[model samples]
Target: MITEQKPLHSGYGPESTAQEIVSDQDLRGKTAIVTGGHGGIGLETTRALVGAGATVIVGARSVDRAREILASLPNVEVIRLDLMDPNSVEAFAKAFMNSGRALDLLILNAGVSFPPELKDARGFDTHFATNYLGHFQLTLRLWEALKRSGNARVVALSSIGHMIGPIDFDDLHFNKRPYDKNISYGESKTACSLFAVELDRRGQEYGVRAFAVHPGAILSGLVRHLSNEDLAEWGVTRNVDGTYTSSGGFKTVEQGAATSVWCAVSPMLNGMGGVYCEDCDIAEVVSADSQLQYGVRPWAIDPTSAKKLWDISVELLNIQKDTIPNVGTNLDSDRLLNVSIEEPVVNGQLSFTR
Candidate 1:
């Protein structure tokens, strides 16, 4: 378990940028996939990773725009992906598998918030579907490639909004309850944290680890739906200064990408998985009454809740019984075992034909 006694670094607060953390690191031959990597913090993340010699794949719903934005980068590729469409996810995974490439880092960073009520192609809540389930499916589909790298890390972007609510299993789709955007987005963010914890629990043994990140607040395209007045009401944007303050504290796009890149490449977190992180280190557990700040919430880090969420995800995605090649024959037993697929010897070279 991660302890709070670890000293905190003050210099790298809300204003730090991604280039600051990766200035001296070498990432040659590493391949990273960043969902929603075309704009905002995602763009900053891709830029930093590419600058450090890593080949970066930017997954976006708008391939043309992503291509145009990242055209100048030498090792960047843009692929089409819409989290709302499972078929799009499946096709993307198939293409990746066909390429026979191994993933060193997977950043599940794409998300939506507080949109008008709508259902996905599968008839599920749009926020929950795009924010959580889409990544869940993508992860499962890419399980083999991730395992092959032998030391892979996945970083899921959660949010401070998770503090607003707990997972509502019975009404996760928000069918019964009134459709409140904040509540729906909150539940999905909470689920993102839980997903990381549970994923680490299952994948740690295979050298695949997972972490959930709260990127801090930044005025990005994510707030396009919210009017200036709406943002001010949430205390996210200051009227006088005409600036945005994150829920915890405002962070630059680079600083927002720091924790994620840290979780991806930092040696300090080796052998540790399933933890929530911020400001380039493992986050501490905060109390219910404690002022909302830089640490993670209790529900976001609860192991029991993580497991429960995993079970529900399995049923919802219909993945409880599916098995990956050479990994195992039955996912039912493996699901219970939570085995890590990143065993060193496998290295993503196993043949699927048994």
Candidate 2:
């Protein structure tokens, strides 16, 4: 478990925009890659990073489309990357690695929800493959480039949906169990958090840090697959003029991308890693029964589960374990057997203390 999963009381809140977070930060020589960077929350993130002087490479499945969308952003490059296709992922990684440019930030921002039921070529659930495994492979494939930076941060865009449940390892692809779209999405997001936990543990020694961010709920391209009825259930209202209004605590795209930007550039987070964040601050660890929709759940940050998932991912990706540096060979049996989390009341408030 991440012992430091507690809020920093960062002055920024739900309304803070990504642009606001990075407005004064200087990233002049940094290099960043944002998956799905040309659209929605990712587009705002890319804009903010570029505005701060970082040269960003936007990875999109459609190169021309991405270029058209990002043509106005200076210092932003569009590259072909289809997260659902392993071959495409490999090709993209190879191209980036061949450039020999160190990677300073990697934002795994692309994801899907409520899409038609499907599977990738490997027969894995499309949700799991694209949202978690794809980013998992990309991070490992670019490990060398990340290491070259001597100070790199990888942000996995998880969600409050992670509170839905932990990864169902026994039936990750819903092979043996009945498939529920919401459950599948939740599990995939949980995997994103677990990936951050394990990646931070392994990568920290090599100057790489990882964070999982729950960009607040927003009406963005991610909701394209949903019907008007679905949006209505989520508290979206149609105006007289036909413009949609989000009233269920939904944020603007800029606000939605704020946590990712804060994770990437905030000096307040300089020494922290492997923690889940929200609203531009480290999130508290909440119990599964908690009604609050903001904090991270214990299952998402369990070190044992994190490592187990990491190994499973490596096997699924067919990557040689030896190729990855600092891959832990043994798991502490005590830690595995006795995973305990305690929340203490401090100043009349529920505070998680690991």
| lDDT leader | 2
List candidate 2 segments past 4 Å from native. Answer: 1-3, 237-243, 327-354
* lDDT (tens digit, per residue) of candidate 2 on 278-352: 999999998987778889989999999999998998788776555655632332211221112222111221100
The digit string of per-residue lDDT tens for model 1 on 202-247 reads 7876778898888887666576567768887766764455555656
The residue pairs in collision within model 1 are 16-255, 17-254, 17-255, 18-254, 148-347, 148-348, 202-338, 203-340, 206-342
Off by over 4 Å in 1: 1-11, 234-249, 324-354
Q: What is the TM-score of each candidate against the true structure?
A: 0.86, 0.89
* Model 2, CA-based lDDT: 0.82
State the C-alpha lDDT per candidate. Answer: 0.75, 0.82
